[model samples]
Target: MDEFLKWYFSDHPIVAATLGADGYDHTLGDWTADAWHNREREQVRWLERLSAREASTLDDAIDRDLVLSQLRGAIAEAAWPEWRRDPSVYLGTIFTSMYAPFQHRLKPEPELVSAALSRLAEVPGVLAACRANLDPDLAAPLLVKRGLGQARTGRNFLTRTIPSMVEDPDLRARLAEAAEPAARAFDELVTFLETFECGGTWRMGERLYTTLLREREMLGYGAAELHEKGRAAWAELDARMQEVAVQVNGSRDWRAAMEFLMDDHPATLDEMRAEYEAETRRAQAFVREHDLVTFADGEECLVLPSAEYNRPVLSVAHYMAPPPLSSSRQGVFFVPFTPDDFSPDQVRQRLRTNAHAQMPSIAVHEAYPGHHWHLSYIAENPRTVRKVFRTPYFTEGWALYVEKLLQEHGYFDTPATLLAHLDFRMFRAARIIVDTALHCEEMSIEEAESFMSTKSSLSPGTAQGEVNRYCAWPTQAPSYLTGAIEIDRIRESFRGTLKEFHDRIAGSGGLPLGLAEQVALA
Candidate 1:
């Protein structure tokens, strides 16, 4: 299993780089149709080989099941026609290939720069492969527009951001020299995407959607069942939010209460950053004081501003986990303030989205005892498969689960803070509904965005971005709610203290929830 895992990582450089695997910084993945087909064939053979083997112990059996699940998911994802239809497929590869080398300081600056330049030289080839793989007839217009936006972002990163980030004059010169062609390649991609006659739909349809839920996610329920579950969860959360709203502002008008809380935001980006940093510390202390869960040794988190390039896509905040394989274990919590180019009104809107009332919940979800804390343990785990194969079900679910855990433990003590937390929870519930509806041919893109806007606290712009993401990536948005539900179920049955249960689950790494249950309960 270790040998196969190493081989798989080596064969896919982008995946390896993202996972912080060594010796892949100077390379990129193959995006050719032949490469995709070849990978599928190899994975199938491994699947067959692994399926025939029997395990001698529970741990070994669990490892085998994890590997098997990963293989099946990879194979199923490969069979999807995304490579032939979605321009974001190649655009994402391009961004990550260039971006991964700079993400961590595992290597010296000179070595990382060299690796990045090497990738920059390969960008034209990647774009060429993208040109060859994509068919306009199968391309969705929304995805094509998104690809164009990403291409522009990639080009700016190559031409403007990379050069500015370098301090050494010689390295800066070399990087600038290498980035020109890559920038040009992006310009050409933008041109290609601009002329693309996109007539295709982004829906995965019932068949592929069901297969992903059952095979990739290893869920017992299908899309329809999940959709119904989402609706029920939404109704329940809605009722709770209404009750909280009455407590907050003496009315059942939840939206009005939410808006009032949002108005109480930090006046500037620096203030926002400070609040989040403080909240992160407060949450960490609360966890330790309550013995919520054990933290990994040397795990640390830093609050920072989002990169200029990332601000376009990341409306508010996000967490960037350390590569499990890298020497650095410091995670960054990125708070994206409105860009300088935005108007004053736009800035206010952005600030409102990351308001004071929501800071505690956001900090809890993205930093302490959420992604940063959960992933730190995964990084410390010895098993390669445990570190390599992550499902959003466990990862996002665990984060969401901790949000509620903290709430239960009094981290969100005020009516306003609790209401903000519930609002975020309701957003995830809406995601489950929209994700299933969009992919199952039940909702159009506009309708999905509208549903998200009406049902959640997301701004119209953020809601549209969310919808676009759901269209491009299926089975992910729902994982937040679905995974949380599964984790709660596991907790209900576990015969242990809350801290012990959390430790067991967090230490188990981001397995599929079913397999995660086995590890947590064992």
Candidate 2:
């Protein structure tokens, strides 16, 4: 199963990588639609080649129905893609960076691009074949419309998002030059769509659309449930933030407290990077101390400025892919270079982002004990089904939960630093309200932005980018809060049951800590 699962995921690394890119946490149409369709035919062919027995289970029934339900729903949702008015719609970032490697294989000419897209149209037929074989009926117009609405929101992101080095004129100039390649590349893809066909006998409607949500939920948690979890988790974190805020700035609110800390705790970009590297090394030490999992020898961290290809202006910081499982090398924690114009105060705020993305607990979130640890473990997983089926929500949620866990474990001793963690949690929780309200609850983009800025006191520029991520991708933003909440609940339930905190990590080597009860539940 492990061998097979590796082969399976490796077969679609491009699709997986594209999906892994950022969203702030929803599946934006532009980032996914073209590549998604491009691979559908190949996926179908892959499925057809699988022996019926091989297709049926990784070993035994790993909730096979749930998997099929998700796949069918994806087919349905892809039928009538909508175009939104957001800049996130067009440019693929780190998540979709995998798409870049394939670009050199294509011609820039519109005719050639069109022909390629037309060839991709063959996917619908393959989907139809699957439908003929399985005859799934999952009609949910509202769900399909939800997809269309999401696509509409993403349309704006395609054309005019800025470079990540917002304050650097030279890099800024370099980025603009960089855009030439990406713009031309994206235009070629868009041009291809003109003659592209969506074939297959399977109709796109309600049932199929709903199934996608259901499958994703099975992989993670239900959307409505996730929102509730996010809200509840936010409330708890808010209470904690209040405590920390008072400690930092007596009687002041979180906003004033954060500002005070930013002003007082300012660090230069170089100083900030050094601190991040030190913090990350400390995290690695913790992982080793706990004997949590295997580690790469002398695994150096990578921290660099965000590139122009995918990173848009107002971007904070993010991580890149770790070394492949076979490589046995450490992953990178990329810190986008700050511009000279950024105030010391601004740079301080950016430093907090390192903690969010790279701290030991965050390392657990991004590399070991989180994405890398678990992914690497699963890459080496004995169970084929488990290895092949990657759950983004589970993966991301676990990482977010790790950040919170660090604080709970008395990791943040400083009042200001603690405030940063609380703010991060709030930022994620706010995503639930922002994403759901924006896409599903009919909130205008401005209303969503206002909600983020006024409610959180985050800078307007940051707030806009955050809201755009939620807008472009729908259910995803809530996952950090939701996934973290779920993991917390499970841990609380097992507080006395487990002998050691790190022991739990060892016990559930490749599975999510949150799902420990599922086997019993099943």
Candidate 3:
């Protein structure tokens, strides 16, 4: 068994890095079994390819140890944080990313989804046993939220909207029409999920967090002092936002100016969804015209409204995970489709949210040049343990950086429109402060919410909700601020080093979609 395990371990890193999974694939689920099968196939492909890459003798004990070491390292690096927090649920995140795109492709029988989820439920135990043999100091953190962000958004979606939709036959029919096959698969998988469990409770302690922080730093950050840096960064972004607000509203107070933008075009949910779809198309055109980034063949994206049950009561907006690499599914920008009575203004607010969330610049971050792009690029690039080991700061930082780059490059040609972009950037920065202060520093949620409201110009309700999420998952929110800052630094360094070569950053075949085009240059 150990020898068999060693052979398995040797191939696992390639599988993890080349065929990676994100967090949502763990916590929230789609209604399909085929997704699981697709992921399994990815693992198999990774193993077969790895075997072909290294013709080294596999019969020796030394080869076995070497292979096993790499395998254990990959699993430990990715799974330990969760295991330390709770040995039982560590595997939840390991399998999450594979579900959506994989399922979309393989479309396995529904029973397969249920069976696969049940099998995954036992992964924590297997990981715990392996951890017993490994060095705790070198172990990985379980569940990095980057992959899981969508899951959090999805959980919020189901908890809030499913009940109401179920009550309305017509609406429920529409939802099922769009989501049934996925939902049914999800229901089958959920039976295997431990509903009573709290994900954070199973997280690592100070020591583990410190170790993970070190691993994160190795990815180019100077240190793991997220709290102080996050606060200071947020403060700076607020100052930038203030300047934009003044530009947009000459004599108007900045706070009032932001609110006016929010209140300006309040509409029904349907109207908001339509506007979102339109804005994304416009944003894409802007990217093409300015030569910001290139979209790959078959990279079709969607801007749809979020189902009522899944909408966050307090979250102004969120982005869904990009589709898996092997399967060419476009990412979706989901807006909340609330009723007309629920603050008709909320609908209009959603339009701006969608514009920011689904913009081509954002698509670059979340999809093309950001998350999806980075992941796909790394998949085909050099083989390093770190390749499979993503640092959220690097990934998220690049995304945030892209958002600002779009604004600077004249994507926001109008004042009021650009003001909204600044406001959103400020909101992201405030998230850094709110998340850091609430978690590491032990600030109360209310205090954090107040800080967000005043600094980011968010509503009290929305502010509270963002604060809550940061509290539930500490260190995660800091990724945006810290990530953007690092990406900017890298870009500046690259520009200085290769001033004439900067155009090479976006040249064809530089880096695949969704990853940082700049990182490839770096």
Per-model TM-score, in order, reads 0.96, 0.63, 0.61
Model 1 weakest lDDT span, ten residues long: 307-316
Q: Quote the lDDT for 517 in model 3.
A: 34
Give the per-residue lDDT of model 1 (tens digit) for 1-522: 888887888788887887788788787767788988887899999999999999998778878888888888878777567887887778777676666556666777898898888888888988998888887677788778777766767777887777777778899888988898888898898888888786887788877787778887788988999999999999999999999999989998788898889889999888999999999999989888988888888999999888765665557587888888776688888887665577878777788889999999999999889999998877888777788878898899989999998998888999999999999999999999999998898998889988987888877777777788888888889998899989999999899898889888878788888888888788
**Ranking by TM-score, best first?**
1, 2, 3
Task: Report the lDDT of model 1 for residue 151.
Answer: 75
Off by over 4 Å in 3: 1-103, 106-210, 217-225, 307-329, 336-389, 495-522
Give the root-mean-square deviation of each candidate in angstroms. 1.6, 10.2, 9.8
The C-alpha lDDT values of all candidates are 0.84, 0.47, 0.46
Stronger candidate by lDDT (1 vs 3)? 1
What is candidate 1's CA lDDT for residue 32? 84
lDDT of 1 at 378: 75
How much is the lDDT of residue 138 in candidate 3?
33
Kindly list the per-residue Cα lDDT of model 3 for residues 163-221, writing each as its tens digit.
23243455444443444343433343333232322234322344444444443333333
